[model samples]
Target: MHPAAQQAISTLLAEGKTPSVATVKAKLTEPLPMPVIIAALASYKNNPEAITHTAQQSQPAPAKPQSQLDRIEAKLDKLLALLEEKQ
Candidate 1:
């Protein structure tokens, strides 16, 4: 199913509204095929929590910051390069 369709279903559930093909289709920002909408709705009806879990898993993980030791090492490397150039 399309991500938008999944999101539409999730949104409808959150708003305490039942998700039918028409409702999900209407909620969608972009146009999708009737079959896709129907499939999504059926899947959602069968396993509501799966939809929410899938949506959460679909999100990209946050980037990790460089460690302080890594930063210090980089600075030391640069300083050594500068000294080598001077010599």
Candidate 2:
């Protein structure tokens, strides 16, 4: 994420929401042109040293896209399948 975006995420997390990265990605995408978004992302990449995991400790909006939840769901499905296979 860009510093701006990272800053945005940290602001959200600070509010007590455990959002996903995708959510932050999506927030930046909203109503903004791609080039602007691209620039912001570039800005973020250029200063990665400044954007460590600490930003996640407190963010504005939830991270995003619910990828973690989805992954968990998929994992559970696989486990369920394995259990059925044993039966």
Q: Which candidate is the best by TM-score?
A: 1
Clashes of each: 0, 22
Task: Score each candidate by Cα lDDT.
Answer: 0.84, 0.57
Task: List the candidate 2 regions with Cα displacement exceeding 4 Å.
Answer: 1-29, 53-58, 61-87
* Predicted structure 1: lDDT: 0.84
Candidate 2, residues 4-68, lDDT tens digits: the string is 56665454456665434454556542344555556555655576444446465544575664455
lDDT of 1 by residue, 36-72 (tens): 9989988888898898898788864655655557778
Off by over 4 Å in 1: 59-87
Best by lDDT: 1
Using all chains and alpha carbons, the TM-scores for the candidates as numbered come to 0.62, 0.31
